[model samples]
Target: MLRAAFLASTLVFSVVPVTAPPPVDSAVDCDYYCDDRDPSLPLSARRSPHRPGTSTPPAPAAVVCNRYCDARDPALAPSNRLAQTVVVAGRQVSLRFDDTDAMGWGAIAGAVQPGDEVWLDRSFDAGVSWGAGSRLGDTAVPPGFGDWRTMMFNVDDWAGLGVGLLRACGRPAGSSTIACTSWYRTTWNAWDRRTAAATALMQRYNLSTGLFDTTGWWNSANALNAVIDNIRLTGMTGYRYAIARTYDLNRSAWQGDFINDYNDDVAWWGLTWLAAYDLTGDSRYLATAKAGADHIFRFWDSVCGGGIWWSSSKNYKNAIANSLYVQLNAALHNRILGDTVYLQRALAGWTWFLNSRMINSSGLVNDGLTSTCANNNRTPWSYNQGVPLAALVELHRATGDPSLLTKARALADASTTSAFLNPGGILFDDGGGGDVPSFKGIYVRGLAALNRALPDRPYTSYLRRQADTAHARDRSSADSYDQPWAGPFQRSDAARQHSAVDLMNAAG
Candidate 1:
């Protein structure tokens, strides 16, 4: 998503055609050339104007070829290219490709100086190694230059047998540090991207602790839920170990069975465990969910006329805590057999929630109730809008009430179309470095649940838009996503990743 406005005037140069290297032996040269038709051979070997070993060396000509081109090929048109840039060492390093010509190169700009080096890496594998063509088109900025680029090289194999991956790498003038952009594969479809995103999410998992590193406790539950959903949706079982790992390691944390003072936190874990039970049929996960649900219902009181308190202190009644309470109880009722008690509690909770006036005129749920038990009218956080949709969906399933789905649809329609909540059709929430980072994903998860229950799947385009934006713009070169789904990826952590992964799961 990095725009062309950032690119400096491109430099063009011609290089002397050298003798072609010996044909690579795939069997013995597998370390450098993994396949028989490696694309790493110098341009002279493929289509140089002066054929190799010619007695009369033809004059060096501006490199020009289609499908297979030398570095800095004049035929590489700028208009037919796809590019993505990342900030590295305080400079812009971009990987650019002209798919029409099956050519790619690297660029560096911003405070450019002599010794600032940029290059392109080609990999027959998925970036596991650079293979033979790595460092292709490597170039450095000259003195007083504002930017520089490497020569063009073919992105496809020699015979168009396969499309390899490419990335832009750079190093500052005086820094030993080297950084590279994420690998770009031209053939990757939506499912391939989702798989990559899920793989990146799992990389943050702490196998020993059964928690995703760089995120909080409750956020880990959401992360686990996203992982489970990814597994179910994609049928990829590689990360299934996380299910038992999280349950076994964290089941005893904080007063046993994921029970904590914050009712919402406990509810997140409860729902996550329920999802695990559904995925793996683990009775322990279901039992833990039941335990957490029972514990959360204990916090519901006459206070605020009947909604769960945010914490054990019972100082405030909030929309999130209560909404989660409704969702957990309703979901438990639907899952458990002979569950009159859970059903009644869910219905009672729903009745009180409807009368609570937390849902505003715009159909978005507000943050919480005021001290006077009226609507607090706090900023309508995305999660506040989300959990309730899930609650309504579960309630509808338990009671077969058509009205529940109607209410869910209204909330879904509002949130999906809201100017602030979903600007330009992509979900937006700054997350302010706290629990906010996890909020948008929860909303999308709810929207997806409601979408599944509806016959029409009205939110299909909406979900796909969010996922596509995140994949194209919000992701870092490492495939990690930050909060904003639009662009300019700032940073990434477990919370941000799970939120994006949830979107991927929904859309996939």
Candidate 2:
């Protein structure tokens, strides 16, 4: 076998480097651990077993770019529309438009210079009625521009840099270029509204006990996630007070009775507190996380060989609770309270999860393990795929294993397919009501974390498209949004609104 492999080493393959189109998340490879990626690199598919050859197999298909231009006049042909050349990043780029009926519908994005002009030919109604408007100078930021540097921590209704967004001006006031500046990010976020929506939801749904009655009842995990988001977005003392108040009501986590009575639900609350501690530096949050982690671990035993039960009763083992364990323990090891025990348990738990065969074919994850220790043929929920996908990413960071990224990439790729995403790459899942409507947002949030670890334009573009769709289609007259991201308002609630906030916030 060794001699046969030696003969296959003579094959030659051409190497061509390509720059990634969108900005990579600096936390992943760009800033600290720069795992520079060149899209032109060929896939690792084997060539041949018999002999070395001069010919090379074709490179994997390039990422497909969806072409869409919103024009006021559908009657005007694309060829007839004037194409203007603008210098963006020192290269003269053409602003092209096609004949289409979409208005405030399609989005285009790119970097821009100070003198660059981005104009839209708008028609309010029929294709025959057309009017034009152009933005100028540094003030020419696209509607919904995402440059946080200029107005950091300040209030502005300028949405965020999502789709169809052009660049903001350069620093020190002149010569603006979007070439390689982290300050000039192109994002698809609706922080102003999304954040506002979340706050409103909290106010409307929150009980005096600090748990939210999001829809009809209080869901422990859902409320925990909301509290974390509230802290993350606002960092206000009021939200922290509520968090403390909630613990006062449900103080049995340390005594092993957890908030919601389910191990997975309790794990979520624990994970949220871990994040809360990360943000606030309060030892109380850390202590709570530690206590809950202990409670969750108590469920682990020889049952189903190795895994945590869905609840303390030990009736069934599942993906979410175990995945959260992996993430929570690994985070504890990395962050403030340095504990290797959590790390050791994290590794062991992740192994059991993988060996359990919960991750199904098509590169997606199933719901949980069956009573017989096999993967339950349950429908793939977005959160199920999301939590595990995020856990894998954390494991990759902890271990520095490249294959972990390969596994994550497979799941990410599968997530963007028809099962979880729409044709425009908008996050899509069965909005079958209850907690189901809120699932896609969790998946999107996880994907955003993945992007920060490993930057990819397709992933960013997918997010931007969804945000644009939401901006154009999802919002109601009163600024409330519906469950399905692809349309007009159907029904509105805290869970769905919170989910929207998650998606739009991650757009940045």
Candidate 3:
């Protein structure tokens, strides 16, 4: 059971009655608003914010309609709808929120277009919402310095982003070689990493069983799952997928030679596989998730006066990892149907995070330990704060713990207002020197996840607005992928195209 924090004992593991979706009424149907009262509007239209007008404004630049447009919009339609189809490895996936809910893929429906106007900000909120298509008018950066790369090589994290975009958008109902190839290659890369790391860890550490070879370190099962799924999707053979078990303390390089259950890698991989099982109904993925869950359970002792250790190392007890542990366990308990033991583990881990790591009054979650254990204690990052909010919400759903909900809401409030997010809710990474996208991406992801978990009218609307603002700024930048310091902003048509896809995906 979750240890009582600020909430009184009355709010034990009892479940709260979820507020039903509001009845649909004749309101300004934000292209994607949800109202149970009126299910007549398309779910996507309901979730969408009310656009200023139905007709899209003219594109700032002209892009070739290409094969995707030829296939999807027969007339080579230059409408915003055609722009909604983002290219992936020379293929484009159309964005239509006809079936999905606000929680699923509503954020990015607007940005994926026939042309690259809107850009997707992956970190801020998955691709449910969009960023700017390309800078609006003169605000747009011209192609130069960063322009050559954009022109010469359209290379981006194209494959991964494509798969993610496709998954969120409707998977191509038909098999497009372009979509398949992009999906295949991306999954292959992820698989390669996971396999290499897992193999190396098991061999080096002789990790036969238990939570991990050492408790203080991290785990890689979840990472492995992400990789494996990619591999399966792409159908790549002999990919030499490598996964590592630990990070070298001196070199700071992730060592792939041994298994350690301390890291929350298991949770991520297991969850991924669990998702795969749901999507594909594969028994192997389910089995793998179960094994990983069992390993996680081994470490769930009443340690450090609360949750499990960050890793096997007694010195490494930290909040970020433990909070992840809470989320992992809770996901398994709530989403996946195995390992009931994780329920108690999730409860305890959440309680410790709330009582110890969470910043009282501020509702911010902190990283328990860092380079300097004493001073670095409780210094929070978006990921640290964000993941816990997600966990708290999930736990609240599973256990009806009002405190968890309150804490999650509080954390969400703090994150939206913190330095991590620009005033408009674009997530920015702090202490990253200034790798804006990567930094903000994680933050945005956390917010997006929270938005999905907690479906309130006010909160959902805010998420939509924030999603729009981030995309607009992102499109204004010279290079979508490169940070300001990434060797002078390089702009490419591919980059612009990607930006549009990213933005539309985020809006969904």
Candidate 4:
């Protein structure tokens, strides 16, 4: 279903004009000015005489600059321009950075007017916070001017320790509302960011426990799967040791063989092992996957008509478990030679899942069924839309059914284009902590599977857009990534890192 038809109660994705409201204006109007004061002076030392007292200035840090503050506009070079965003009424805010000079500036064009104002917002902490609105290089459009720009400012802090995030912001004359473009990283390099993210993720790996630290059991399975895919996709052999290390160490830790009460958990590990087997052609990985699949199938019963229970407690039947069940079984059928048992099980699982009412009217699958086997109509997470695509692709491979690809494409198209799922062309998730952080990775991993199986390879551009945005905006200096792939890096952990890694792999 499209997000508009079935919006989640929490975590709504809307494209508001402004990401953050401007700080409250002081009672007295103040004139912003650019003075002869050294740009290297601390911001507090260089504040304008009429600056508002109520506005809490950014921490005292030298405003390093490479060129004269009001020198020629960097946008004139064209190649120095990094990114741009439309604020309102076709007004484009461009972020321009000159690598040689280590300076950046903001420019506004396209429907510019005399009263329009342009300025730069610089943040040392990846745009989490910046000085009280448009403090640096604030400029107003003059009569007959076609475009306007802010004065150049340093792209880094005084210490040059971290790359700063800069965005162009503007307001038309007489309009109280202010709009800003999305943040752009000063040191923007997609390949470098991907490598750094993958390397940093391995640093969080716990060699002793055989799992990525700072995440849970199922999350580790997904993380390991991402690492495996990264190796398989990029042919990076440095982290290959993690494949056997995780399996050997964790295999005996939980239930002695990657089996637990949660069917989804077992299925995740099963899929992880399947990826490992595919990468290395190790029979042990295949055997372990088969064992895990067998254990998950044990939860299948007559309850909810036919689908397997979510856990041993049998409290509910959810989309994730059943979707993973179908994918795992169908994948096994394609892998094992002359395996009719798994093939029949996969077919039966798909038939039952298709008949179930979990899939809503909009082609999106809800969380699960209610107590009476009706559609629960819960939040249709990105992952919920994902695994089914992988399942259908596997089913198509096993039976050579053309209709399976048709169904998979519909779900993929709905998800990649949906406003709620992929707002502003970027995948949206609240990242409300815990397992939610890992959900996007699982979604994209499944999407990549479908992309590989298709002859047209349709989802390539969509996946690449996601990878590029995350690499540019959602990453930290240490190469860790946060939940939101768009911007304003909040916090990072193993789950978030692995999810970003999954995107990098898929994009390639």
Clashing pairs in 1: 71-151, 71-152, 72-151, 72-152
lDDT per model vs. reference: 0.73, 0.50, 0.36, 0.71
**Tens digit of per-residue lDDT, candidate 3, span 225-326:** 323333454443232222222112111212222223334545555555565565456566566566666665666555445555444444455665677677
What clash count does candidate 1 reach?
A: 4
- Ranked by lDDT from best down, the candidates are 1, 4, 2, 3
lDDT of each residue in 1-508, candidate 2, tens digit only:
0000000011111111222134222121133111221223232211111111212222111111123222233234333222233234443332232313111211123443333322222211111111121111112344455321211111111221011211112221144332210011111122355544454344333333334432322233454565466557654333455555555655543333344345665677677776767776878878877777877788889978898877644666777778888877776666644567887888899888888888887767777887788889676777777777677777777778888777777788887775444645566665353456667777787777777788554478777777778767776422345767886555455556667767766675
Worst 10 residues of 2 by lDDT: 1-10
lDDT of 4 by residue, 1-508 (tens): 0001111111121233444445432222222311212354345433221212222223425455434332346655334755555566667666677655556777888888898878876655334456532347888889988888887776554343333556667877777666666655444322355555566576556555666655667778888888788777666666788898777766775465687667887899898999889989998888988998888888888977798887766778899999999999999988899999888888889889988988888888888999899999888888898899989989999999999889889988888888888778899775353567788888998899899988899999999999888877876544668889986675667778888988887887
Q: Candidate 1 vs candidate 2: which has greater TM-score?
A: 1
Predicted candidate 1 versus true structure: per-residue lDDT over 1-508, tens digit per residue? 0111111111211111222224322121123211122134333222111112223212112233445556656344553454577776578887777655657778898877799989876654223344455567778898877878887776545332232457777888777566666666442222376666766676566545677655667788899999899888888776788899778877776668988667888899999999999999988989999999889888888977888887776777888888888899999998999899888888888899889999999988888888899998888999999999999999999999999999889988988889989777678874464367889899999999999999999999999988888877777544667878886676566778899889888887
- Per-candidate alpha-carbon RMSD to the true structure: 17.2, 22.1, 21.7, 15.8
Per-model TM against the reference: 0.67, 0.58, 0.46, 0.63
Count of steric clashes across candidates, in order: 4, 8, 105, 3
- For candidate 1, the 10 contiguous residues with the lowest summed lDDT are 1-10
- Badly placed stretches (over 4 Å) of model 2 are 1-191, 205-207, 216-227, 230-241, 248-260, 419-424, 431-433
- TM-score of candidate 3 against the unseen true structure: 0.46
